[model samples]
Target: MAVTVSPSRPHDTITGTPETGSQLTRIALIGNPNSGKTSLFNQLTGLNQKVGNFPGVTVDRKSGFAQLSSTRRAEIVDLPGTYSLYPKSLDEKVITDLLYDRGSAGYPDFVVVTVDASNLRRSLLLFSQLADLELPAILALNMTDVAERHGISIDIQALEQELGVPIVPMNARKGIGVAALKIVMAERLATHPVRFWEPNDELLPLVRQIRYYFNLHNDYLALHYAQQYRSISFLSVDDRQHIAELVAQSGFDATAWQAAETIARYQRINEVLLEAVTVTRTEKREPISNRIDKVLTHRVGGYAIFLGILFLLFQTIFAWAQYPMDLIDQGISALSELIQSSFAGPLVRLLTEGVLAGLGGVLIFIPQIALLFAFLAVLEETGYMARVTFLMDKLMRPFGLSGKSVVPLISGLACAVPAIMGARTIESWKDRMITIFVTPLMSCSARIPVYTVLVALVVPDRAVWGFLNLRGVALMGLYLLGVVAALGSAWVLKTLLKARERSYFIMEFPVYKWPRWKNVGITIWQKVSAFVWQAGKVIVAISILLWVLASYGPGQRQDAAEARVRAAAPAVATAVPDTTASQELERRVASVRLENSYAGLFGRGIEPVIRPLGFDWKIGIALLTSFAAREVFVGTISTIYSVGQDADLGTVQEKLRAEKDADGQLFFTPARAFSLLVFYVFAMQCMSTLAVTYRETKSWKWPLGQLVYMTGLAYVAALVVFQVLK
Candidate 1:
C-alpha cells in the first residue's frame, strides 16, 4: 500500500518524516469489548506502548506512537470500550467525558472505531453516535477474517459510502490490511458526511440554545451537556447551573429523549446494513464455540472444569518456574558472597544485606509471576475467561456480587490496586463498593514469595499419589481460602448494606479462538515488569531502612551486648579439639549483637502482641515490614537473618529452612508457617491497595473501614490457626 500525507502538515526536509520536534497527531481507538480493538492497538504500537490512567479517572489509558507515513506519525490512544455514548459505569463515562471535553489531555484529533465485522449492527451503534457528535472517525472493519469464516461477507465500498467515512476491512490479529489502514490514516479523513441522529422538534429549541450558548457546532454534543451537565467535570459550575435551569425551563425528559434517539439510530443502522452487509448460510449449523460452550458453561461441569484448569495452572507455575527461580536464587547468592569477600565496610554490608537481599527476594519469583500472567493471558485471548465470568455469576450473585465483579476479583489475584480500580466497570454503586471492600482479601501475586517460601518449608514437595504435587495443592488451597474469605465477607457486607437499586448481569460470550501469542507476550511483559519495578522501589527503600536499624543500636547498646556475650562464653581447652564450642560461641555473639540492635527492640515490642499466633520477634519484624507490600516479607526475613547470622550465605528459603528456636526446633514450624500464610491471606498488607480504594471511592470511610476489618480478621484468623495447629 502507498502512503500519502496531507499537504497541510509540515515535514522535515531530509528524511521526509515529521519535523523532529513536531507534535504527533492524536488518534483514539474506540470499540466495544471483544471487538479486536486491543489487537489493532497492539499491532499499531507494538513495543512503544504504555499504560496509565486518564486525566482525572482511574480507567486505564493505553497510548503509543504509530508511524502512519514517512511524514506523518500518530499518537494512538486506546480508550475504554463502550457500547454507546450513554454512560452506564465509570469506564463508560470516561468515553463521554473525553469525547465531549476538547480541553482534556486525552481528547483525540481523530477516532478509529473498531467494528467487529461479524457483529456490524451492534458495533455501528457507537460509530453512529460518534458520527452524530461530528468527530472525525474511520470505521475499522476488524475481525473480517473471523466473519468470513462464519459465512459473513461485507461490501467495504458500500459500507464506506453508507457511513460516509473510510472503511478498512482487516484482521487486526493477523495484521492483514493494516498497511491500507495506515495509508488511510495518513490521509486525515473527514468526518462522516451524514448526520445520523437529531433531537426531535420538542427538544430542538433547547438543543439550539445550548449549542449557541456553548458555541458548539454539533447539536448532539450540546444536547449531551444538557443531559449530563451535573456529571461533566469540564463544565464550569456556573455553566452547569445555567444548563440545569434551562433544562428545568424546557421540562426536558432525558430518559425518554435518550430512548427515542437510540431507536432512531438503530433504524438508520438497519437501512445502511440492508444495503452493505450480507450473511449466507449454505446449511443450518451451530458454531463450534456454541458446541464447546455446552460443556464449558454447563451448570455443574463448568465449575469442575474451571477448578481443574486452576489446579493445572498452579501446578505448572510451581514446576515450570522452579528451575529459573533456582538460577536466580543462586545468582543472587553468588553476587552477595562476591561482594562480601571483595569489600569490607558498612556500605558493603548494606549493598549485600540491604539492597541486593531485598531485590533478589522479589527477582527470584519473576519466573513464577511470568508464568501466572502467561496462563491468564492465554485464557483471556482464547475468550474462555468470559465464559468463566458467566459461569460464576450464579454463585457470585448470592454473595451480592454481579458477574461484572468477577473481572476485578480475578484481577485481584494479580494485584489488588488495579483490581480495585477495575471495580469502576461495575455499574451499581452498592456492588462496586462491596467489590472494593472484599477484593483485598484475594491473595495477590505479591504474596507468592511468602506463600512459596512458607509452603516449601512446611508442605512436602513430593507428589500425592504420584500425581499432584503436595506443595502445589497447598498453594491452591491458600488461593481458594482467599476466595472463600472474600465471598463470605461480600455476603456479610450485602446483609449490612442497604440498597434500593437492583443489580443485573448482562454479558456477551465471545467466539472461541486461538490465543494471539503476541498479545499474550505483551501482557506477560507488562505484568512482570510492573511487578519488579513497582515492588522493587518499595523493597529497596525498606531494605536500606531495616539494615540501619538491624546493624546498630542507640548509645553503644550493640557493643555492650556483644561484649556481654563474649564474657559469658566459657574458655575452650587448647589441648582438646573444641571447634564446635568456638563456633557456638561466635554464633551466640552474633545473635546477642542482633537482638540488642534497634530493629530487635522494635520487634520485641510487638512480640507480646503476636505471641499468641506463635510468632517470635523475628516473624513480628517481618509482619510489620510486609505491610508496605506482602512480597517484602521475604526480603525482611532475609535481611534480618543475614544481618544476625555469621554463617555461609544461602537463598532466603535455605536460611529460613535452617532457622531454629531456643529449644532447637525449626523456627518456622508447620503450625507457625501455615499460621503466617493464613494471616497474609486475610491481611490488608498493601498500602497501595488502600490508597487506590480511597481514590476510587473518593471517601476515607470506605478505605478506613476496609483496613480495620481486614486487619482484625487477619489477627483473629491467625490466632485460631496457630492455636488449632499447634
Candidate 2:
C-alpha cells in the first residue's frame, strides 16, 4: 500500500513526509482517566498555558504552547481525558470533535493518543478507533514504570507495526521518558501528512458507511463506532464536548462500525498483551495497594471507614485551625487598636472599628479553609476520591443522584461554588442541574465557625462511641445530614425532571501510588490561594461598604442618640469618670452614625419580616452584613459586639454569650441558637456564593431557584425548631 502526502494548509512545509508542512499545528492529547495524560501535558507545556472553559459549557479547556525543537512553537490542546471516541458523553465527544474536525472549534492537525501501559487492551481500543479515523496520531504508552512493576511488558515495535503509529514509553510522574516523548511528538508533527491516510480497505469503507449512515458528513470516524460496538465506546466518552462531536460525526454515517472493531481491537490488543506482558505467580501476595483498597472499598465496612474519615477531617479542620485562627484574630485586633490610637478623630475610629475590624472578621476563616483544601487535595491526588464516588454511587442512585455526584457534593463540604462548577462533568443536564442545586446542602466549611461557637455554647464537648469524641461525632452527623439533604433534594428533582438512561459508571481504578508531593503541594496552594483571594476581596469591599452605611445616618437620628446618651449620664451615674462619659459619648456618636447610614437603614427595613424568626434588629443587621459569606455572621457579631466594649479576642465569645434582649433575658438562648443554625442551614445567605454560582452556571434562574427552595425549607424547619425547643 503506497501512500501519498500533500500539504493541507498554506503554511504547511511538508516536502516528502506528512505533517512537516502543516504550519498551524493543532495537536490534541487524549487518554483514559488516570493514564497520566495531565502529567504528560505538564511535561510538554511546563509554564506556558491558559485555562478556559469550552464555549457554551463549564467544562475546562486547558490549552497551552509547546516549543518542540523540531516543530518550534506548536499549539497544543490538552483535551479532557477520555477512554473512547463514542458520542455517549460530553467529554468523549470533545475529543471526538478535535480528532474528526466536527464542531465550530477547528479540528486538530494530529492527536497524541495516551495509553496506560498496565491497562493496555482497554486503552488501545481508543487508539484503534483513532486509527480507523485515519488521523495523524501517535500512541503514547504512559505509566511504563507501573506496567513493568505489575509484570506487564509491551512490545512497542509490534504495537507500532500493528497500529501504524509510533508508540513512545513515558513515566510522566518522574519525567523518565519525557525527553523521548517530546522527540516523538516533534518528529511526528514534522514527518506525518497534514491529513491522515488509511490503508484503504474494509476498515475505511466501513467507517465511511457508518459516517454516511449517521449523517456525520464532515469527519470524526473514530467516534462513530459501528452500531454493534456502540455500547462499549459509549462508556468511554464522558465529556459533553466529545459526545456532541461523535453525534455530529455519526449523524452522517448510515453504516454500523461498532461490531467490526469490538472484535478486531480486542483480539489485536489481547494478542499484543499476551506477547508483551505477564501476571506474577504470587497472585495471593497482597500489594500495598490492594491492602488499603480492601478496607476502603469493603461493601459494608467501607461505609464505616468513610464516616470515620469524615469525622477526622472535620475535627482537624475545626480543632487544628483554632490556634492560628486565634492568633490572626489577635493580630487584626491589635492593628485596629493601633489605628484608633494613631488617629484621634471620629472618622479614624470609624475606619478602624467599622471597616477594618469587619474585614478582619471575614478573613479569620482562611486558616481553616486552607487546611480543609489541603486534605481534599491529598485525597484527590492519591485517587481515593474516585473510590468515594464509587462507593457512594450505590446509595446516592436510589435517591436521584448519580454516584459520580458524590465527589462534587462532598466537595461542597468545603465550598459550593467549585462544587457547582465541577458538576459540568455530569452527562445529563438534569443530573448536572440537580447536582448544582443540592450541593449547597453539603455542610460546607463556611458553617464551621457557627457550629464551633454554638457547640461550645450549647452542646458541651463530650465523648461517645466509647473511644470516639462525641462533639466531633455530632459535627460529623451534621455534615452527614447535609449529604442526606442533598440526596433527598436531588431525588425530588430527579422525579420532577424527565429522566435519562443511567450513565455508564465507567471510571478507571488507577493503581494507587504514593501521591506525588509536588502535585499535592501545588494543588493545595492553588485552591487555598484562590479561595482566600476570592473571599478576601468580597469581604474587604463589603466591610468598607457596610462601615459607611452603618457610620452615618440622616438628620435627627444623630442628634437624638447624642442627646439621649448625654442625658442618661447625670441621671444614672454621677460619680463615673469624665473619661467614662467621654467613652460613652463616642459610643453614642458611633450609634447615631450607624442608624443614619445605608447599611443600618437596610437592616432595619427588613426587621419586621425577620422578627418572627426570633431575631432582634441587631441580628437583622448582622444578617444584612453576612451576605458576603455565611461565616460573616460570626465576624459581624464579633465586630458589632466589639464596638460597644473594651473586649478583645479573649473576651469576644463571653461577650456574645452574655448579650441580652430588651427583656434582659439572654438573646442567644437554646431556642435562638437552634433557630440561628436552622436559618444558616437554609437561607440563601451568602451573596458571594450566589454570585459565583451565577457565573459558573450562567444563569440567574438556577441560583434563584436554589435560594427560594433552600431558604423556604430553612425558614419552616427553624420555625419548627424554635417553637418546639422554646
The top-ranked prediction according to lDDT is 1
**Candidate number of the best TM-score:** 1
Across 11-37, the per-residue lDDT of candidate 1 in tens digits comes to: 221222343566778889999988999
For model 2, how does the per-residue alpha-carbon lDDT over 508-613 read when each residue is reduced to its tens digit?
A: 6767666766666554554445545544565566666666666667767766766776677664343555766665566555555555566767778887877777
| Residue 462 of model 2, lDDT score | 74
Candidates' TM-scores?
Answer: 0.82, 0.76
Candidate 2, lDDT over the whole model? 0.66
Q: After superposing candidate 1, which stretches have Cα over 4 Å from the reference?
A: 1-22, 236-238, 280-283, 404-483, 493-503, 573-579, 607-619, 625-681, 685-707, 717-726
Poorest stretch of ten by lDDT in candidate 2: 1-10
Computed on alpha carbons, the lDDT of every model, listed in order, comes to 0.80, 0.66
* Cα shift from native, residue 380, model 1 (Å): 1.6
Clashes of each: 0, 50
TM-score computed on alpha carbons, candidate 1: 0.82
